[model samples]
Structure formats: C-alpha cells, structure tokens
Target chain A: MTTGVRRRLGVEERRQQLIGVALELFSRRSPDEVSIDEIASAAGISRPLVYHYFPGKLSLYEAALQRAADDLAARFVEPHEGPLGARLLRVMGRYFDFVDEHGPGFSALMRGGPAVPAGGTYAMSTVSTTNALIDSVRQAAYVQILSHLGVTDPPARLELVVRSWISLAESTALIWLDGRRIPRAELESQLVHDFAALASVSAAYDEEMGALLRRVFKEEPADGPFADLAGRLLTLAT
Target chain B: MTTGVRRRLGVEERRQQLIGVALELFSRRSPDEVSIDEIASAAGISRPLVYHYFPGKLSLYEAALQRAADDLAARFVEPHEGPLGARLLRVMGRYFDFVDEHGPGFSALMRGGPAVPAGGTYAMSTVSTTNALIDSVRQAAYVQILSHLGVTDPPARLELVVRSWISLAESTALIWLDGRRIPRAELESQLVHDFAALASVSAAYDEEMGALLRRVFKEEPADGPFADLAGRLLTLAT
Candidate 1:
C-alpha cells in the first residue's frame, strides 16, 4: 500500500463511487465485456479495495441493478389516486422517459439475461423485478378503469383488463425499441389511443357479457333486452 | 478419398440436412449458445461443407427460422370467408398450434435477432419478414371484422383496424410466451375475449376522438370534451 494514497473516505462514499464507476462501464459494454479489473482500474483504486466494498463482481452488479430497479419502482407505484387515465398516463410517461434517458441500462435490462457468469443472478433478479412492476402497473391501471366504468364486483374482470393492458404495453415497447419502419410519434400516439379504447370498451362490454353469460348458463336467456345478443354469442362459440 | 468413407449428397439434400441439424442444435440450445462447429460435426460433414450449403452461421439460422416463419404465415394468411370473430379464432388457433408443434423453432424466431452479431442487417431482415407476416394476418382479420360491421370506405379505416389488431395479437402472443402462469385453455379463451373487446373499443373510440378533435379545431365546445383530456394526455408527454 502506498502511504501517500488517501484512504479516508466513508463507507457510503466508497460504495457510491464503486457503483457509479461500475454503471458507467456496464452501460458502455455488455456484462461479459466488462471486468472487475477494468472497474478498479477506472476508479483509480486497487482491485482488493473494490473487493472490500463488494463481495465480488456479481454482488456489485446485483447492488447496482437493485438501485436502478428501485428507482423505476418508485416512479410506477403508489400515488395511484388521480383520475384513472391521468395516473396511467403519468406512469407511462415516466417509463418511456426512463428508457430514453438511460438507453444503455434500459436496453441491457430489457434484453433480460446476463452476458457474463458473474451477472446471471443480477440479470435474473432484475427480470423478476420488471415482471412484478408490470403486474403492479397493470393492477393500478385496471382499478382505475374499473372505477371509471362503475364495475364493483367480478374478480376475474379486473385481472383480465390488467393482463391485457400489460400485454399491449410490453409488446409495443419491445417492437418500438427495435427502430422499425413506424414513425416514433405515431407509435406513441397509437399506444395512447389503444389504452383509452381498451378502458372505454371494457366499460360497455363487461356489463353485457356478464349478464348474457349468466343467462346462457340458466338455459333461460328467453327475456333480457340483449337476449338476441346472448344467443349469437353462443352461436359464435359453437 | 475412399468412396465408402465419404458419400456425396446433392446440394438440396445437403442444405436440408444442415438446416435439420442446426434446428436440432437450436432446440437443445438457443442460437447464440450453439456453434457452427457443432452443427458441422453433427451433420457428418466438414466445416467448409456446412458453409458450402449455407453462406454462414447466421444465414443457416435465418434459413431455419424462415421455414418455421413460412408455415406460421401460411396458417395466418390462409383464406377463410367467415364471421370476424370466427375467422380470428381460427387464425389464433392456428397460431397456438404452430407454437405447440414447433416450440423450439417458434421460440427461436419469437426471440428474434442474431444473438451473436452476424450483424444487425440480418436482424433487420428478420424483423421485416416477421412484420410482414404479422401485417398479413392482421389484414385478413381486419377484413373479416369490417365485413361483420358492414363498413367499407377510404381504406384508412381498414388500415387502422388492421394495425390495432396486429398490435393486439403481437402483444397477446408475447405475454403468453413470457407468462406460463395461466393454463393453455384459459389463456386462449381470455385472448379471444380480450381481443374482441379491444377491437370493438378501438373502433368506437376512434370515431369519438376524431369528432371531438374536429370540434376542438373548429368551434371548441363549451366545457369541451377535450379540456381535461389535454391534461391527461400531457401526463403522457413527460
């Protein structure tokens, strides 16, 4: 150890420095392409110093990933009390902004696997966090839409809505990232419109589907105003 | 060269053999995990002979991918003059059937992109082919839906329906692949129901949004429908 080198930084400062340097390197290269040696060299510290702060490269990566994930989770959850559409729009905006600002980190996370053996657990943990985030967002959006629609009961209904919305959002984001032929603005507009439509349509249809389904099971669809509709639904199923 | 030791095969037979062997390897490991050397050895041929049939590893992977893609496209594009819902069901059934039958090949294609960078151009081409097939299936489904609705006009309307429907299908499939939480039968049922709802809602909302937008441009209605809608949309703008 060179006695001339300063080593008086607090634990928090050292941890933060290591993460900041690691994130920069990780963003620039895939996990396999980056090494702890490179991280220590870039940070102007000894490899053992880096090891003292984190158990290993994998542990460092996992800590960094959890920090980034926590940031995203904070933006998407809670404060769910606004008008249904408004709240969802806010979450979506935050989501897209996060990806745009941090394209490299977002890309690695979205790509959903490790590029190195040391990164495998970190990569998988991030994926699990993402899935949970998606599920939570879906639920928030579903509750908002159902409240707007005035549907109080029917356990399966809200789950259906949330799953469907998540499906739409995730798929759109995946295709959009590939830089396909579609103009970016139009792609964004399309998603917004679809979300609005999904909410509005469920409001109208669920009521009808519920009533019609109940009657068809009774062998007694002989009376409701939408009796003909019920008959046709069964016919289509057959 | 002992004649008995090296039996010669024609170009077509050799190409087919190479694809079969590559696909087998892909089944065991994803495209990125498999090597050209393994493929050549498994096919009982020299490394150069494998290249003789296919330009490179990427081309061989693409060829194998294209075969499965073609089968899926054929099923999706197959004609059926029927009700919108029925036709969509048939197409959806075909899609799930294709995935079930060729789980590995479908998974590889669905997990699109040249994992090991034979280059981005190959990925771009694969994306285009995939987008085209998706578009085709979507148009067929749209035509059926519009026929059911008894609407025929300026082509833009049909294009809108097709685009939305394609997005719906693409999202549904991705979610289904990612989430094995739901039983297959239940997933299929929910898919049909949700898509039908989406199609109906999208149609109605488009018309409503278009009219409201026109009024905002022209007269700006008192306590206008778009007043709060703007703030809600601004939430989307970030």
Candidate 2:
C-alpha cells in the first residue's frame, strides 16, 4: 500500500482523487459491488477518511457517475467545419471508446440497476437521479447534434428524427457492449449512415427536412460518408 | 359496483376477471396510484377475494403486465402474404394503438418505476420481474420481425439493424406519447419507413444485409413504403 508514503492533499484534491479511484473500481465492476472500504484502500486512505469526504457510498457513486456523464456528453462535441458524417463518425468513435472502457458500469447505468440503492429510504430518489443523469446526457447529445445541424428551430419531424437517431445510437452501443460481434469501425460508419437514412426518410415526409437534406448534400464531398451512403443506394437502385 | 347482483365465477374465471380489472385500472392510471381497494371495487369483489387469487399487489401487477405483454406481442403478428412494408405498417399501427390506449402503464413499464414495490422486501425481485417482462416483450417483437424477414439465421449486422429499429420504434412511441403534436398516422407510417431506412443503411455495410435488402425490395410494390423510401432517396440523388 502507498499508505506509508502518503502525501498531503487539499480537500478538493482529495475528493477528486477519491472520485477517480472509485470510478476506476466502479468501471471494472458494478458500483454496487464496490464498497467504501475498497475505494479507501485503492486510494491509499482510510475508510474514515473516505467518509470524511463523502457521506456514503451512494454519494460517491453519484459523483463518479456525474463525471462519467460529463465525459460522455463531451464525446458528442465536435467542430462543425467538416462534413456532418465525418463529424458524427468521430463522435461515434469517441463514444465507443468510452463504452469499451466501461462496459459493466455503462450497462448498469443504462439498465438502471445493480448500482441503485436496494430496499432503502433513498432508493426511489437515487433511481430518479440516475435517470435524470442519463436524460441530461441524452439532452446534451441532442443539443450538440442540433448545433452540428445548424438549426436553431428544428421542425417537429426533424426533432423526431434527431431524437430517434440519438436513441438508436444508445441502443446500438448497449447491444454492441453485449457482444462485440460487428467490427467497431463498421458500426461507427453505419451509425453515421443511419443518421442520413433517418433524415432522408423524414425528408420524404416533410418539405423542411427535404430542404435540410439538400443543404447537407450540397456540403458533402464525393468521398465523404454521406456520399458513400448515396453511392451505395444508387448502386442498389441500378 | 354491481355489488347488488354479483354473479358467481369459477376459480379460473375469477382470476381472469381480476387480471382484466387490474389491467383496466393500471391502464387508466399508474399502477401504484391504483390500490387493492380500488381493484376489488372495480372487480365487484372483496379485497380478501382479490388476495385469494393473488398474494399481493406486485403479483397482481405482474399478472396485469403479463396480459398487456401478451397483447403487445400479438400486435406484431401478421400473415406472411403481404408486402413487408404493409405488414410492418400494420404492426406499427397496432403497437401505437396500445401506446395510445395505455399511456401511463406503458410509460411506467418502459421507465421501470412507480408500480414497482417501493423500498420493500420484494422491491428488487419485483423490479427484475418487471424488467424480465419488458425484455420478453422485446424478444417476442424481435423474433416476430426476423420471422417476417423469413430469416432463420440473421447475420450480426442484420441483427443490429433489426434490434436498433425495435429500440427506435420504442423511443419514438415514448417521445410521441409526451406531446403527440405530430399526427399519429404520420408517425406510424414514418416508423415503417424507419424500418426500411435502417435496413437499407445496414445493407450498405454488409453483403448479407445487401442481399436481404434486395429481397425486401423485390417484394415491395412501387407504391409500397420501401419503394417510397427509394423514390425519396432517388429524388435527392438527382
């Protein structure tokens, strides 16, 4: 243990350190499976010291999940200079990176279980907090995608398309984490193509989406992912 | 309450009547909001009689959910005589009919909340049973879709596409149930179009998916949803 050589740390620094350690442990295993003792031991601190920073395991688990949520939300942030398909592909790449790194934790969070308080007074509130955190992440991703689309006021159909695509990406990741059967790169590109496909189908129904598609296609290069989707569809049509 | 002229029912008939009453109450409001007293009153029976058929509220909720789940799974069943698009549209129609009718119960079931036993000895097990019921419904829908495609062995990408579409439909319905500003008919047809869109995008990535798409398209008439999607894409291409 590093207890023998423990260095002084500020309160904020210690809390951050503890959260990092807890997240590390929680990532490897479900949060419910981890304990305050384990976190303290991993952090080279005492259980009492861990309690001094966070009241209980639930608070500590929320802190770790908060950090993970922020990191996940950040993965959707990309500059709007490149083609949307490539930007989305990059986002998917980083997204899968996080999912790959934290399989069990991600599953538990998405499934809303195992980490939740069991048969306690705080169970319902904790469940809602977990769901709120998940919803916030989805909202962040939705806003980021809308920003990339450059639409301040998305039509109802466009909104449906975006929200549906976000859910598709989420479910795709959850299923992929179940078994890494399909190649990651293919899934990533296919997700970008899925965005195009969703938008195009919506465009067929709404004039605004039709116009949006035209603008999107006008910016896409011949070798970009959107063009790639178009080429495949054209080939199939022929 | 029909208490003035109660009719005798067999044991099996009594249980079935209780289940139907519970489902009706649960559908009108969240299951947690409806109580044993209300259920008994609705069934025109005593609380002890209700308990005679089921142990507690959780078991009764499960029985109700089981009936709802079976009804939902059956909504996906269609004769293999028509175009895939028409068949899927019919499925979406009936699926949304359930969502529209049982808004609160469907939401609670999907979100995994409220109706669940709150911080009790049976809470965890009840939650898992609720989840199991939801998963079973998804499994039934997935198997039904694969059967519709007539594929005994679906490749990984095809599987992903199908599973992702199922999730998409679910999320779409959930979101639509929130505001429901968009016309129900539009969303229903769009969901069918979404299936074609998702499958076609996957086709671009895998030969198996590509072959599946060709078969799907060959069966789709010019005026069908699949052809409509093709028309939209081709219009954009030119």
Candidate 3:
C-alpha cells in the first residue's frame, strides 16, 4: 500500500511470481503457516490478486507442489545422448541441487501426509487420496528415470528394478544431505555402480537385461563411471 | 457375559495378545479407522482392559509401530554364517515376509506421517524428524548388513554406500508389494548384486573393499547366489 505505483504484470508473470513466492515460504514453513497476505506482500501485490491466481491457500500450495515436482522431475529429463553413466551423473547433480533447496518440502511430500495438499493438480484429493497422490507422482517420476536408463519400454520387472533404484537414490540423498560423511561425487558414482550391478543380475533371467547391459557398456566412455563396472559385468557375461 | 470361561492370562501375554490383535486390525486399515472397543472385542477383552495396557489409542499405535520396526529390523539379523550374498538373500526373504504380512503397516511407518505415534520410539519429530526416523531404521539395519559383509566396523564411506543399498531395498520391497510383477527371487538377487557392485566401486578407494571382494569370491561356493558375480570379479582379479 505504501509503495506508490506497482509495475503491472501480465497474467502469466503474475501467476509465476505468486507461486514462486509461495513456494519459498512454504518450503520454510507448512501450508498452514503461510498466508495469502504474505504471498501478496512478498510479490508487491494485493491479497485479492493472490486469491485470483490460486483461489485459496490450499490451491496456492498445490500449485507450488506441482511446480516443485515439475522442477524435480525435470532434473531427471536429460537429452537422450551420451553414455548412460555420464547421463546419470548429470541427472544426479541436478537431483542434489533440488534436495539441497527444498529439503523439508521434498521430505514432507515424499513421506505422504496431511501437511501437503492435493488441489487440482498435485495433491488435489482429500485425506483418503494421499496414497493416490504419492503413487501418481512416484510412478510418473520413475517412467522418466527408466527411460533415461534406456529401458524406455520397461518390462514390469525391469521397471520395478528402476523404481527400486529411484527409492535408493532418495534414501541416499537424504542421508547425504544430513551427513556429508561421503563426498558428493563418490555418492553419485556409488548409485551408478548399484544400477550396473542390478543390470548384471537381471541378465540371469531376462534377455532384455543382458541386451541393456551390452548397450550401456558399448555406449559408456572407455574411462568413466562404467570403467569399474566393465570388468565386473563383462566377466560375468562370458 | 458372552463366554462362560474367563481365562486369566499373565500381564505380558495379555499385552502381547492385545498388540497382535491391534496390529492385525491396523494392518488392514489406517490407524484412524480402528477403535478401542473393536480392538478389545477382537482380543476377547473389555475396553477398560485394553486401556489398562495402552492408556489410549495413541499409545497402542506407537507400540505397534515399534513392534513392526523391531520386527523388520530383526529380519536383517540372520545368523552371521555363509557368504555375504547368501546372508543378504536370507535377510531379504524375511524382509519380504514382513512386507507381505504387514504391508500397510510397514508402508505407514516407512512413509513417516501423523498416522503413527512418536511416543518413545520412532517418527516422533517434525518434517526433519521424518528423515531421522528413516535414517535411524536404515542405519540400524545396515549395521547388521555391514557386519554380515565382514565390515565389522564400516568406514564412513562404506557406511554411506550400505545406507544407499538399504534404501534401494526399501524401495524395491515397496514396489514389489504393490505389483507382484517381479518374482520374489529376482528382487532378492538384484539387491545382492547392487551391494556387490557397491563393493567393487569402494575397492577403488579402500583396501577393505578389496579384501572383502577377495573374501566373498574366495569363500563363495562353487554354485550359489553369486555365481554370476564370481565370473566377473574372479576374471577381473586374475
């Protein structure tokens, strides 16, 4: 109110600004602690404008969750080029960045609870639908990850394996954040190594696992994440 | 009034029976849906007796969670015999058993939410605490796994890798339960391989990893869970 003339923002710009402000605030505090007024003030707009964009606090929170999920999901989406190991390393780097920025929000959503919302987009369901919310977000994220792993059309078993890897990454990321006991690069490499081991084991039954392993090995740089994996996997195949 | 014989049981047996009844009840539905009167009836006792043991519904829920966590943690503690891969497979078998018998209960605790109690044992904190519950359960179990792997005292980095592997197992178990798409044997073998792969990566930095890899290969039977691993590791060392 005191600041004389506010710069006019386009609908999209205003919507984005409001969501960004709300995201930052909610990242620090729960949805209940955040107020429409705070979001408006943060963006140099009025409370009504905030309401116009989000309708209510729950709606605002859902938009933020969608934005955060989209941002995190986007990290796993890299160009479908390069050796699988290098692509994974790059994706993990972006993942670490997201974990660092939204530690609380990420855990809250991942844990599946009442603190988050399920508005029209992200969590839009009532209390009974929390599982659905978690399932949708998790499944969608895994589809992207399995694709990056070159199992774009993952068989049910291969897809399960990739989903397991994703869960392991989530656990490792949380631990890594708390106890920087291990170097970031080492942690990333460890994950890549685990996936390699899974692929090797998967070969015992599924020809697809064997073929995928061969492709990754052929595509991998001679001296990169796959170097150590090479001797282990290559020896096993023969 | 219903039964002619009112059998008197010891305090501990009665308490155990009550917990078992409550667990069976809650395992089917979320904690919110179960009531004290029903739990008492299921145990063939009065509501006052149930209250006498648990004081309230929250206390009963907390006891069940601690029991489930202990039960799952207990699975990781097989007799420390046999090769590491065999030991892991055994433990994973027990883990899958826990996941199957107490699917929803295991998931509810693992997800870390308001539905469970934090009375004295676990998940009794804020969003930050959610990570702690996961970390606590994970570290405790990994300690056993590391012990079985001949890492009686795991170094900081190896410990981190084990934590990551445990996370992967948790994720795989969750996915496996949701979709019986993957065979139980396949899932177990994949986890064993992931740990083996992590060991190889660690060998690059630590002498212990090298020594253990040597031991696992040396002690491995002519034919066992890690036959595939032996081909790769043995060939590489030569």
Best by TM-score: 2
Residue-by-residue lDDT tens digits, candidate 1, B15-62: 887787787676545576777888888887888878878878867876
lDDT of 2 by residue, B42-71 (tens): 888889989999998888998998899999
Lowest lDDT sum, 10 consecutive residues, model 2 chain A, at: A113-122
Can you write out model 3's per-residue Cα lDDT over B112-221, one digit (the tens) per residue? 45354323222223333444555567767977876766667777767767777777788787777775787877777767776766666666556666666677666777
The stretch of ten residues in a row with the least summed lDDT in candidate 3 chain B is: B117-126
Q: Which regions of candidate 1 fall more than 4 Å away from where they truly are?
A: A1-7, A10-13, A24-38, A41-44, A51-59, A116-154, A174-192, A200-205, A208-238, B1-70, B79-90, B100-238
- Per-residue alpha-carbon lDDT of model 3 for A1-238, expressed as tens digits? 2233378888998788778888887776655556677778877788887788877776677777778767777777788887778888888888888877877666555554546422222222433344455556667767776777656567776776677777777877777766567777777777777666566556655776666666667766768776766664444334
TM-score (all chains, Cα) for each model: 0.50, 0.93, 0.77
| Model 3: pairs clashing at backbone N, Cα or C within 3 Å | A118-A123, A118-A124, A119-A124
Q: Write out fnat for all predictions, comma-separated.
A: 0.11, 0.54, 0.41
Give the better candidate number (1 or 2) by TM-score. Answer: 2
Give each model's whole-structure lDDT.
0.54, 0.84, 0.68
Q: Give per-residue lDDT, candidate 3, residue B14.
A: 83
Candidate 1 chain A minimal-lDDT segment of 10 residues:
A224-233
CAPRI docking class of candidate 3: acceptable
Q: How high is the lDDT of residue B223 in model 3?
A: 74
Per-residue error for B16 in candidate 2, Å, reads: 2.1
> Once superposed on the true structure, which residue ranges of model 3 sit more than 4 Å away at CA?
A1-15, A25-60, A107-137, A146-153, A215-224, A232-238, B1-5, B8-13, B28-37, B46-56, B111-136, B149-153, B205-208, B211-224, B232-238
